[model samples]
Target: MIRSPRGVEDILPSQVSQYQWIEKEASSLFSLYGYEEVRTPIFERAELFLRSLGEETDAGKQMYIFQDKKGRRLALRPEATAPVVRAYLQHNLYGKTREWRVYYLGSMFRYERPQAGRYREFRQIGIEAIGEGSPYLDVEIIEMAHQFFKRVGLDKVELQLNSIGCRKCRPFYEEKLKEYLKKNMDRLCPTCQRRYQYNVLRVLDCKNENCQLVIREAPWIGEYLCEDCSSHFQSVKEGLKALGIKFQINPHLVRGLDYYTRTIFEIISPVLGAQNAICSGGRYDDLIEELGGPSVPAMGFAMGVERVLLALREEKKGIPYKRLPLIYIATLGREGWRAGYELANLLRLKEIRVQLNTSKRKLSSQLSFAAKRGIRWVMILGEEEVKKRRVILRDMNSGTQKELEWEKLEENIEEIKS
Candidate 1:
């Protein structure tokens, strides 16, 4: 038996319903917030990730890079934000609107050690609001994310918020941080040391015990935020408060992506323990410009689908899989089979889920198959029933059945099920 690649999952039929339920809830909810769905290619130029996520970032290093037939380097998108921004510029959407509100649900590829609720091929449901610099938009995005978890029945998800300054003032904070790190070099982890050299902001988010201690006392960017960023951060807090969306101000909340500037946040649930950030995103005011586009301010976040599901399970929440009532047609000989096939089509037109029997098995075997599949309703069309212009609707649950006139089959199925 051939096995799937490491760190990937098949999303078997048993689990698909949970995913569908989540996606449906997301699509329905996001649409109400003026976020249209957008889908981009699964892969893009490898340089896109390098430029957007930074070469030192975790997403950057874990990208699934490959060369195309034309020898152009490409990578399966490690995240969707970069690709969404790319499409926003490629299609010149900026010319059409002051801001673009869009949501996406898709797979993101990354190479990492497979852990619980994390995978190399994981699904993300996220939304991006590009254009404008109003802090109200930030509040809306954050509230919308909070609403998503609430609607998904997730409880106790706390939002950790921070401002990482911007181009103007971040340099000054970096200098102070560097000076602080220089004295604690021996206490830093290897990864933090390297991150300090390439991207000093990343060290604040280091998971290492020592790096976190060093970061806990390091110079926070909040104090160095420029006047404009300071005001914007204040407004975001006020707006969130106005909506009763509670959040905590964390000074060491630097995101993994380098482009993120001002107002970064991660939503954590106690149920998930240490690696508990089910969703994280923030304002990348300069990302569009960095990607060779105009200075468009954008706010977005991605939620790990697998992680959310895992959290749901950890909380002992039931999966809301909507199992529609199904009617299984068990036919006997050629005559019954033909009548059953025709009746199945007619029943389906009325929006009934009909499972027409295709095998040449005995009635007992056919009924046994339906029971094993947990089909509660079975429509029996034997030779006698076909000749009598009627059929038997069996209730698998109670082992009780009733005969219905073939002419009134559709009406009877609807009436009996109800």
Candidate 2:
């Protein structure tokens, strides 16, 4: 038998309830925040990601790129934000509302090495708040993320926050950082050494121990924030404080995306070890304009579905599965099978959860099958019942049986089961 690809796994029947719970809870919570759902194509023009995420970032390097028959360069989306912005622009959504609050849940593709919670094809739950740049919006989005974890019963996550500054102040900080990195050039890792020239701030985000040691002494962007950025960062902190949300200021917490500006954050879960980030996002005030849309300041975040599941599993949190069918109709002979099919449809039409067994088997065998499948109630129909215009209903849990006329079955279902 052919196997699934290396980095992707099928979501089998047994594990589907967990995913369903997450999606349902997310939709309900996002709706409370006035965020409507938006879905974009799985594959978009490769240039969408290239222009939004910088060419030098890991996202750019790891994108699943290909050319279509039309010779158009395309890619499976590496992230959701860029495609959302593209959709927002193409449809002229900005003209309808000053701020567009939208959320998304979908699969994203990347060509990275497969790990415990990381995959070549991964699912993400994300939101985008466009046309607003208020410091309060930043805090609100952060609180929204925090509340989601809380609602999902994840308690071991930490929120790491930072301000990478804006265009006005970041250039000065970059210059100072470059000067310091130059002195420690010999001690820097190969990746950081390369990042030092192109995007020096990314060097602060390096995970290598030696590079982190060197980065510890480097100047922080917070120290060089211009007046406006300084005030914005302070107000964001005040907003978080007002709402009683706890966060830590991490000077080295520059997010991996190029479009990020001012505020950045990551919610880390210790359960996953090194790849512990369950969710991360920040302000990207200029991305809409950069992608050929009207100038719109936006802030959003994306949470990894796999990572969140891992955290929930480590915590031993249970996700309630959807209710099972209360009734299973078992047939004995050809006439009984025909009656079972008709009755199954009738019950379903009345909004009852009914499963009809298509296999023509002995009455004893059908009851055994229903009991093994955990079905609470089983309706046994045979040629004798059809002539009598009645059916035998058995309570699988109690082993109690009852006779009911066909006309009374719908009205008495709940009472009989009880």
Candidate 3:
């Protein structure tokens, strides 16, 4: 027998309802905020990620990179933000406008050790606000995430936010951080020493226990924010407060991506163990120009669907699970089949969910199958009922049966809808 590849999954029909619930809730919320949907290729030029997500992060370090027949380096997207920004530039999405709002739901690929809620292939729902760089836009996106979690019943998740200072102040802070690390280089881990030269900001996220200890006292970048960047960070906080959104400022929340500038955030849930962040995003004011497009500012966030399912399961909030079919048409013999098919077609034309049995099983067996699939009503179409131009509709829930002529089925569906 053949086996499926590692790190990928098949979402079965039984679980699709939960998936739909999350997507619908998120889609409705994003639409309410005026963010339209956008989609991009699952793969792109490898350089897109190498240049945008940062050359030093884990995604860049561990992505699934391969050469196509044309010998162009291509990679399955490890994250969505870069590609969205790539599209924004490629299509001139910003054009003369100062801003645009976009959202997407799709799967992302990464080659990593699969453990707990993390996977080699995962689903992500993300949003990007590009063009304008107001701190208010930053606050708006963050609030959207907060409210998304709140509405999804994961209200316990905490919002950890920080400002990673832009190009102007980041370099100065990096120098200071390197100097601080230099004094304790021996005490620092090898990775920290390597990061000290190129991207020391990432050294703070190191998982090595001793490395964390060495950098525990290291200077935080927030303290050294230049005046303009500092003011922007302050306004972001005030805006969050104005919207009644509470947050904890963490000086070390430098996200793994390099393009991110100024504000960064993570909506973390403690119930999920080390894999805590359910949703996260930040600002990248220079990413547009960096992609060789017009200079524009953007902010966005991504939520992992698989990780969220884990948290939702832990919270024990009941997602409605029902087999609420609109109508079920049961057929017995040749003549009944024709009538059942006609009735099924009519109900479907009226936009009703209708199921017809094609099996040769006994009436008992067909009824059992309908009940198992949660078919709410069963319209028995035996020869006798077909001859009368009527069908016996039985409410599987109440076991109540009534004879409804063909014309009355549409009305019955309306009553069900009501």
lDDT of each: 0.91, 0.90, 0.87
User: Tens digits of per-residue lDDT for model 1 on 103-204?
Assistant: 999999999999888899999999999997889889999999999999999987999999998899999999999999999999999998898899988898
Off by over 4 Å in 3: 186-193, 321-326, 397-418
Best by TM-score: 1
Instruction: Work out the TM-score per prediction.
Output: 0.96, 0.92, 0.93
Candidate 2 lDDT for residue 100:
90
Native-vs-model 3 lDDT? 0.87
What lDDT, from 0 to 1, does candidate 2 have? 0.90
What residue runs in model 2 are displaced by over 4 Å at the alpha carbon?
371-374, 387-390, 395-418
Please list the residue runs of candidate 1 whose C-alpha ends up more than 4 Å from where it truly belongs after superposition: 322-325, 408-418
Candidate 3, residues 45-159, lDDT tens digits: the string is 9999999877787788878899999899999999998899888777776774657789999989998888988888899999999987889899889999998998889978999
| lDDT for position 224 in model 3 | 90
Clashes in predicted model 1: 0
Query: By the lDDT metric, which is better: model 2 or model 3?
Result: 2
lDDT of 1 at 134: 88
Sorted on TM-score, best first, the list reads 1, 3, 2
TM-score of 2: 0.92
